[model samples]
Target: MVENRRRSEEPLHCLVTGASGYIGGRLVPELLAAGHRVRCMARSPGKLRDHPWAGDVDTVRGDVQDAESVAAALRGIDVAYYLVHSGSGAGFEAADRRAAEIFAAQADACGVQRIVYLGGLTPRGIPESSISPHLRSRAEVGHVFLDGPVPATVLRAAVVIGSGSASFEMLRYLTERLPVMVTPSWVHTRTQPIGVRDVLRYLVGSATMTDEVDRAFDIGGPEVLTYREMMCRYAAVAGLPRRLIVPVPVLTPRLSSHWVGLVTPVPAALARPLTESLRYEVVCSEHDIATYVPDLPGRPLPFDEALSLALRRVREAQVATRWSSASAPGAPSDPLPTDPDWAGGSLYQDERLSPVDASGEALWRVVEGIGGENGWYSFPLAWAVRGWLDRFVGGVGLRRGRRDTERLRVGDSLDFWRVEEIEPGRLLRLRAEMRLPGLAWLEMWVETDPQGGTRYRQRALFHPRGLLGHVYWWLVLPFHALVFGGMTRNITLAAVKGAPARVNEARAVRIRGDRRTRRTSQR
Candidate 1:
């Protein structure tokens, strides 16, 4: 057994998988701050480049399913954090089991000192079969690690309350959007929610656990509250009118998830598992983690305090990572086809060019702040209708919004589209995530015309999958003038009409608001 004192005295080398994901992305910096050398492994390493701590840690392109890559990533690592999970879906359990086995095998082969994993908190007396598939799979993964040759520390948590997290987003939208909600019976179920800060702290501290202490630990916030209580508290924290929640037993997990999909940014696919997990009570059974990583003052923040912190981050747009940080599975990764005569089937494009009476900087500002509360500058009804239709069909609606109102990174999600690429003041390209027959992309460019004026260029590209895809594109072709055309004309007009001043004013207000918040917290 490794001595805890010896392990704590030396800085350990850590390997963090799923570095592009929500928890993993935030964990890298925390580990680095604790004097550990970190290496990050992701399927797309480029996705992690935009993070502020990207340069501080080494990154490698690797997937857990690939044994060779996993082995290579685990090489020379004292501790490995298994943060990757096949989010709820078909065959996710088998995939998760296989991935865990491969990870454990590699970690053992590499002589890793400890394996740290974050998993869902299961109800104490509930049978395994009664648990949701998401939680069941997580438990199986934890078992794989604990029963392996290497020592493991599995931290089980209920819903994580943080700005931009899926669970918190669901809670925020439901409570804020619907003043009166007919909620599922699960809303009455009790849960011990944890803050993201505490989760990260426990994850980092788990690295030096004694070898004999290979087991799962229940970690959660200081208070245990029902889902209904959480929603009420969330509304209070957000300074909104108290929500009236009516619990109805008729709404099963499936029906509730679909309802949540329609109302929140989280789509049905992701919401289903979350809603299902809420069916069981998940209060923490013990606080054994404090025995090893002693809690400091105000440690494991109170539920209301966590909610306040999350709300503050959302209001200030200081969110470090979002649930949308990870790319949706099967999202198109192909670069925009530049060749007109390419052999990869038909490519359709609607191009719009307009001369702006404003500087290029002004035009770029309007483009960057196009979505979220600043509604897309176009036929408002058309965009809203389209977003609703997408949501109805189990797609990510425009409600997902943008991570930051005034800025965008490469992997940021903008409405139903993901930022594929962005060049500071020149270009911004978005790839569609809404369900469609084929692939689609929207590109906006700010350039200087030959006449020394600002040129705003917009293009909508579609790559059809089959005959249906081609037909689908043509069917929507007639509305291009009103949809795409209006976007172009209105965007340019907004840019010319005091866009620079508006942007600066908004920035100033945000800065002032942040200062006030800091002073209040201090007082």
Candidate 2:
């Protein structure tokens, strides 16, 4: 019976509603890896970055609010992952509540088999059950979905422990920045934290195993530790000794949310939901989920183990952006070096300027000619090879050509470089498409003053990921200089040659026209 059920739902064609979110962003890739064809539904289809397999999956731009769009997005989608929440939207609770109902109904109408959601996990059966508005809303959203549409397989989980996640980022920044911590009553609350990997496994694994479960279930990591303990464990994995953790009863969730905004990268809007949920004890009530998701059956992730792995992945992603050619094509061939001396990823930026006598117009032409037919103005072969490798990292290889022969505009994608900023004869700055350990930018400018016809300059900017990220900058200084200098010189020479020819042609045309007019007058 299990085999038949598994085969019937084999390679589930899944549709994720919040494919652009952090969880959904990771979930799309996970679902695909599990032999499922995924339709990534998000508010902005363009927001979907260039993943190597980006073309394989379907992408639909639709909001949960618009019934028509939602119905269309859910059409033919088997397992629709309800990853959306009211946090960032206009109608926080009402909008989310309504949207889920509409989507659940739409999913039912569309024949979707399951609606997988990751929401807040609060102990519901307790005698004096008191939960915050945020937790209550989350629970309501799940219940509304499960009751209406397809069998809703709700995976109620605590704050996911990973980088780039709001909850995780709040925790990460609080511990990293504050060597001496202050007090929050919620710090003493016992909670079960789960690793992102386990959460993903349970969500994907739930699709195949649906025999006994008809409703929502709690999903958490292996340990039930206090908020303070979770913080200390995170510190240990970060290789830092735990600082003093003091729990104060006076600090309210409102006050704590603001404090988080000041201390963590998490903004106030994001912090409030997490901070509100922190008031209640977020632990699993039953262990009956053993037979379903075997990966997490025996044990949940140790706080330290989850922290180490999640941090490593974030570091890797940051660094991956650096070395990956998609970060910047035709960029100086010099990549940030691996200082085994550092951990995770290397992120660093090097900036230098060399004089190249090129006209603004000529330089503009060269910049326009970048990518596609002309190849990158600097390190053409290296750029091509790098782009080819980026294809391995799941990026768009040098396929998209320029829109026009000589014009540029914003929002236009040029090969790997999205048109970030453009000035006709002066500046062209491109954000890196290739992966990097951190954020990076490449810029070329032709500055023309009254005294100077044009001055060509190039800059490479990198934002480091961590300690190693800083080290990456110092190591690649010389090579960046070399590659950047060569590119600048080439652009200068190309522009210089191009300008005079046009000038001479104009002069010659004027002389010929003058002679013709003089002869006509004599006649």
Candidate 3:
């Protein structure tokens, strides 16, 4: 390929699947920064439209399981990054195997030069059957690529220490939420965790490797620490007093996953696989990747440094992509909010319309700034109770706050909801991520009334699935007045109070501009 020249020497056309996912979202910018042309393949390309680098790359709607789509995405691509994985769930292994096989076959048919995969690192001596289904599925996917006609490089990593990563979030929540933790036996298991930066470096470098390298490489940081030691070190790094972690033998992976789900923002479906994989030592067996990628000075950051970096990102809210960036498998497939109510069966709506005293822009500002630190303008205790209930049922709790403080994006996660759609200052629609029997959406709109005043329209819609869905909807119907009604009243009041400041700021800017113009005219 390209007469043995370094891939860096010539810009390679790269196709990144799962562009909306955590790793794939971060990897695309890195590849582009290195002068590689990137084409992203996503099932919903709109999810990526809000990304800063979205305009620089080409995005196509495609699913890995669809052979025709995969083949089309792979065409005219030098290297294809397989970042899409069926996350740990029931029947995930089969789904992973099928997707990998399809992707490998499509890559081969498309004449792709290289295929790079990021997979979990399995224990050194353990058999595939002994490992967790998540890790085994990952290994199987890697093997499928390596065994394919196209040359493939599989980078196996242990726990990735990064802000917005599932592993780091689990550790962060567990350590921060509880000063004393009754943990599972897996806390003593050893793991060599790697930083997200190093993982991306290795991934980008793999694209340029000689065609001869097609096997799997274990990638991790220099230090290896037990889960207990990591938590202790994390507490220390976070400036918290040492944690009390009691390892109990009675807690199985399933129980521990539930416990983690209750305590952390990560749902049980994801936490289960993570806790299961921690049962064995996942230290890197070899550092053979350095021979090709070659680590730079202070390249693979130490455990504490990685922890510090991740913490800093979390504190600053600079995390680029979160684990929630990718929707869970089998997410609700109901009709969108734009669709007519009749299209979706048995649609229930709790609609509230309030006339606001403030400008539409002011109302919009309050709407966009809702959630996160600014608690939902309704009943705080009710929202907290609802969040706790969701966590108890293995749903993404309200702890998964908004990415930015005052900005609303198409795919941003706000509390227990995901931003399904946003029309600038006009409309903000959020889909429920909490565990519910039916699909739910909350739509907030800033509109101008006939009298030329700001009008705030709020609607909570639910499309019932079955009998249980209808029961669930009626069960929560009584609280709608306090929850939805209070929101309408408080939001408008906040906008009214905030509108004067906005007007003053605009006036001040105009005054300064006028003075500057006067001085320019005199000169």
What is candidate 2's lDDT per residue for 248-328, written digit by digit as tens? 789888899998877755668778878988888878986555567775344566778778766663333233333333342
Over all chains combined, what TM-score does candidate 1 have?
A: 0.66
* Alpha-carbon TM-score of each model against the true structure: 0.66, 0.64, 0.67
Question: Where is the poorest 10-residue window by lDDT in model 3?
Answer: 327-336
Residue pairs clashing in model 3 are: none
Clash pairs for candidate 1: none
lDDT of 1: 0.82
Error of 3 at 438 (Å): 34
Every candidate's CA RMSD? 14.4, 14.5, 12.6
**Please, what are the lDDT tens digits per residue for candidate 3 over residues 277-324?**
999899888999999999999979999988877655223322112211
C-alpha positional error of residue 217 in candidate 2 after TM-score superposition, expressed in Å: 1.4
Q: Total clashing residue pairs per candidate?
A: 0, 16, 0
TM-score order, best first, reads: 3, 1, 2
